[model samples]
Target: MGHGWRTLRRKILTPNVSATYLETRGFRRKDRESQELLEKVGALFLAGYAHAVEASSIADVEARLGTIEHRFRGFAYEGAGMGYGMLDGLPFGHRHHNDDFLAGPAADQIYIVYCGIGWAMARLPRFRWPKAESLDPLLRWLVLDGYGFHQAYFHTRRYVHEHYQAPRFPWPDDESRAYANRAIDQGIGRALWFVGCTDVAEVARLVRTYPAARHGDLWAGVGLASTYACGASRDELVRLTELAGEHRPQLAQGSAFAAEARVKAGLWIPETDSATKILCGQDAETAARISVEMRPEHVRNGALPSYELWRQRIAEELMSLGGVSK
Candidate 1:
């Protein structure tokens, strides 16, 4: 498309900037610092989305995304992933946009990119959803994590307060379909961190309102978001660890995943180090190493997808270390 048309497309496609504001979304405003940090994340995400839809090529998108600060840069790539995923879903656009992005500029940001596609999934019609066959078998579940986060973040009353769960997610077109809701719940768990504005007690209370069975996944999500997003203080993180109790293993597992993501993307910050230590009881490098070492070679083996198995292995490993309870 021409530059003019692309600019128009970007304007039309991107959500209003106000959508990122805490007041606009009715999300909690626990503290000024946390609120500002989360809002900046939203702004960076939108900036990345704009760049992706308007840029002429992947290189252009990469150049624009690189301008984002190191800590927030992954989020921009994530937004770019969403932009490319949206473009790929459009009737007139080539289907290879996400593929090209994953193979190129998004290589190190794969986890965030896959989650970004989930955001596109939330916006795109069900018929236009990216084909399950095209995604990584193990990590594709992260897309649902993205989707769940989108729904919970934007439709908090239903997905969060009401605890609504998608009955049977029809993506991926496989036997693993039944597990889709769990993956999405993990995403919702992540959103709760933002919705609570990084308030440890409030986030925990919200998770408690859900069914006991879902608490593990939800807490895991919280761990991922709190660690990856880095809005909470050392005290808040410790409080979260105390609140997690029996789910600490799952929480540690999620934290480890965030550690790996930040470390791999070269976005590791002081907050990452502190969060990993407090939540996972390991330094960022060791926590990240645990996540890497525990990854299953295959994407599928038993009733659960390899992703869940990978998660299980990580949790198990962490629990064995006595850092988190069994």
Candidate 2:
């Protein structure tokens, strides 16, 4: 999938490659409406790109941007769209993970990156998932909600193990890097909590229970319960509550901040800082160092997956091929 994604990125980003791929695939030219719509979406993404960050602090928005891309990729798998482009580097109306905004940049890049995820979503009928209908609101919700923190989180293997880990994928040793960790395990667990905290279900239920609690308490109540059920310790749960506060601001920091706090303050015994770094787009080596330093026991015990070597190899290949650039 990664290799295929790299190919897709090059094909989409390089006009010559794009033409060649289209020719090889016998693809037709996209109509003007499609092109114009793509442009409009790009404009929207650019407009919100700076403020798109949910966290108050950014060492590099690009790092957090990688987190958003990671989260959006997970969202793509779970029968929904994050309303962004493919994280595999296929640009479409999608905002770059980096903070610097260049002037007079090509809008095509923005649209392609931002809308790349939507493009993938459009291909989902072949995968037995429902087609996305007008992803505008969905995408807005995703970025605004801090890249669906809970959704990205639910895809982790630990969540699945806590729920249905036995006899399934990602055995104890492979738990951290299992394929299922990023999709089924993490997505479902996080979705439940995220939905529980918002009025999503209530709003859906409101169609039946008109004049009922308008997505406020009901969502938060369910989110709280889901958080607890997902093995969050009492202190951790309180911390989540504190971050959420009263209004539960539609921002991303609560989750990122909480993750940082848990590890730094020794609140929750995390899987590894490397795993968290992966969420933030750190290369494998950096992630490993952070992980080992943060949790020596996990590293010595072989609890953390050793993907750094493979990641490095892939990164080298990507750099050689110009599939990735600084």
Candidate 3:
């Protein structure tokens, strides 16, 4: 497809647009089965907290989260799969395996999990939602992908490009909003998760966040989140990759290559390479092309690899002779 046609195709077929026009504004259009499922998950956490939400101990909350993860797994390839939901969810009925979950149910898991985190932090009476500080370093580390998803869910959308560069601080509420503003709900949600864990140092925090709960999905989220939002130094990401190799080589590979992809696409800061410096033209087209080109080499017809084999090879090609410390 030509670039112009691709642009239109994206506007029509992109996942976020489906969620926006179909789910958020018109969720009630088809009786909101998907939204209701999300609410059920939220209510599970709310009830788990004895209705006090964030009042529960970390262990208690995590135990409930275990139950919630089952729902997410249902959306994964391992489970029954997302099946594009019963309503106007993102279409992947034709997708074979986990990509269906990646494109579809993953978003649902994120929004619902983000809500659960907020609920766990919130108290009644005043009903104030703190900045999620109550979640200790470990718990905060746990939701890195959901946090990244919360943001990428919006930033990756066609609407943000049609509207503006990205959302600014002092973000407007949905009642008074544009595509960028509303779409950034994903990022804003992730920011809260990030802030909750920021009290710890970047590398340590990312490492702590790498417990093998959701396996590759969680690691992939970390890879993208660190690249797009963590604002860590290049050296730090290298160290992060090394550390991830210890836990799961794929985790390391995912972060390493994801960082490379984002840098090439202008979505990330430049590292040591001068080539990347020029790549940072902030040209959206370049980013889009990089995204298209980033199909994990050798995967025919765009079958994304597991976190282990995904982008690490590309990262190897991009790395300089004197790269991060061993």
Best by lDDT: 1
Looking at candidate 3, the ten consecutive residues that score lowest on lDDT are 78-87
TM-score of each: 0.98, 0.24, 0.29
Best first by lDDT, ranked: 1, 3, 2
Q: Name the regions of candidate 1 deviating beyond 4 angstroms.
A: none
Candidate 3: how large is its RMSD?
A: 20.6
State the RMSD for candidate 2.
19.0
Q: What is the lDDT of residue 282 in candidate 1?
A: 90
Q: List the residue pairs that clash in candidate 3.
A: 54-120, 150-186, 151-186, 151-187, 250-308
Choose the strongest candidate by TM-score.
1
lDDT string, candidate 3, 158-277, tens digits: 321122233442212222223223223323323322332211133234335433332334344444334333434445444455554433333333344334434442333343132122
Estimate the Cα RMSD of every predicted model relative to the unseen true structure.
1.0, 19.0, 20.6
Could you give candidate 2's per-residue lDDT for residues 117-142 as a string of tens digits?
A: 42333233324211222222212112
Candidate 2, overall lDDT? Answer: 0.28
lDDT for model 1:
0.91
